[model samples]
Target: MTADSGILVLAGTPIGDVADAPPRLAVELASADVVAAEDTRRLRRLTQALGVQTSGRVVSYFEGNEAARTPELADALEAGSRVLLVTDAGMPSVSDPGYRLVAAAVERGVRVTAVPGPSAVLTALAVSGLPVDRFCFEGFLPRKAGERRSRLADVAAERRTLVYFEAPHRLDDTLAAMAEVFGAGRRAAVCRELTKTYEEVRRGGLGELAEWAAEGVRGEITVVVEGAPEQTVVLDAGEMVRRVRVREEAGERRKEAIAAVAAEAGLPKREVFDAVVAAKNAERSGA
Candidate 1:
């Protein structure tokens, strides 16, 4: 690629501690041709903290201006300018405002690279005491109650660990919703103010965590919920019918009952229905 062939550099800013800033971050911040920061004021503080002076032009690239500013930044890169992107914290585009610019750069044949750094997702997961062998990053849960509950229900049976970002004010309600859907006894960890002075990681059943969060919480919150417990016994055809019957007796319609049982057993609803029907036929034949 030619020197002026435009390059997009995404840098990970320290989530909390300035000491975590990598040497390469300082180098790029000072030497890049253009720097796009989520918050220019925060960028100034970071530069000052790192004792690094940027010779590049600084521009805001937050959620509000990301759409309008994207084209301008892409043009800079196309002109062979080295553009560095830094979010307010954590990696860009992880529930932040870096995806659009990155996508724009890639579409225009601009080179894209990143400076590896601290990540709250990884940090929280590591310290969550939950299974990390397999996990999913869920970013932030939906804001509205109905939508949020619907979304949480979708993952209620997810077997892999889940990581999510949540606002402080809504932590209690979110945790409560998680408890209602995922189960009151499901284990979880809430890592708050990670890498900061008041950092805390609370681990407990979803029910207890909900109660705790109800008291009060502050700062950035990352939740790591343990996956559904491993099922020791696979549901045989007969057991599947019984499970569906139990749900049906509990006031669920037959269709909804089958679906609930199938979701719990990680099976298809049609499979559960056939099993229940087969069991009914066997009973009639024996009679």
Candidate 2:
């Protein structure tokens, strides 16, 4: 923490739009004694766009070489050279590289700081209609369906809004798994290419969004799902029937709908089925 020791700066970059880059990022990029970037070519492009000249020695520090590069960067920091870490987008060490270097610096007692910039996670959450007062960031799900579903199941009862990152190619499959594990009626938002020219935010129930993603999606993506109802919210018969009807309206069969609704509401399928039947019977009697 002494002035004799250099600082490790973790700088955030624009996720999509270059203009979103902050002034502090430009200053860090230009002033650091050593710059460790996830993508050196991308860093070059960034500095060119920002009209900032990086006078320091720029080196690649991606996942592949971060282990090998950490010690070298640590040596520089110990020698009183300010080291700046930047990823392709967003903050380094956030579902990205730079973790190794940061941990190494911390172990060596080197000070660490950050130049906060645009973040896709925060941007998506802010735009998502879902409640953000309490939320969990699940960076990405497993590539396999079974593992992904199991992961979703673990958070099935999570009461905080959930955010996730997904590849464009796997967006459809991920959304489908979410619909299955969380129920089709669960509300979510899919944010695509935030801050970009084609930025799009699609908010709807899981089933609807799954259908939309099935047609294919492109660009960077972040998904935010609404949390389960609070434990205090009573899932009465009428409410149970309403949930079942919502799933059915989204193309689920009545029997399948009943099971999903029951699971989400923490009730038995028999109870959901009875409630649905009674609601229908009452409607018929009224007619």
Question: Each candidate: what lDDT?
Answer: 0.89, 0.88
Off by over 4 Å in 1: 1-3, 232-260, 268-287
lDDT of 2 by residue, 187-274 (tens): 9999999999999999999999999999999999999999876544468998898887888889876776776666676665677789
lDDT of 2: 0.88
Which tens-of-lDDT digit does each residue in 1-287 have in candidate 1? Answer: 45668788889999999899888999999999999999999999999999999999999999999999999998888888999999999899889999999998888888999999989999999999999999999988889987787677566667899999999999999999999867799999999999999999999999999999999999999999988765544799988988878878888667666755665776656787899888899999995
| Model 1, position 284: C-alpha lDDT score | 94
Clashing residue pairs, backbone N/CA/C < 3 A, model 2? none
Q: What TM-score, computed on C-alpha atoms, does each candidate reach?
A: 0.86, 0.81
Q: Sum up the clashes in candidate 2.
A: 0
Q: How far is candidate 2 from the true structure (C-alpha RMSD, Å)?
A: 8.7
lDDT score of residue 256 within candidate 2: 67
Q: Candidate 1's C-alpha lDDT?
A: 0.89
Which candidate tops TM-score? Answer: 1
What is the TM-score (0 to 1) of candidate 1?
A: 0.86
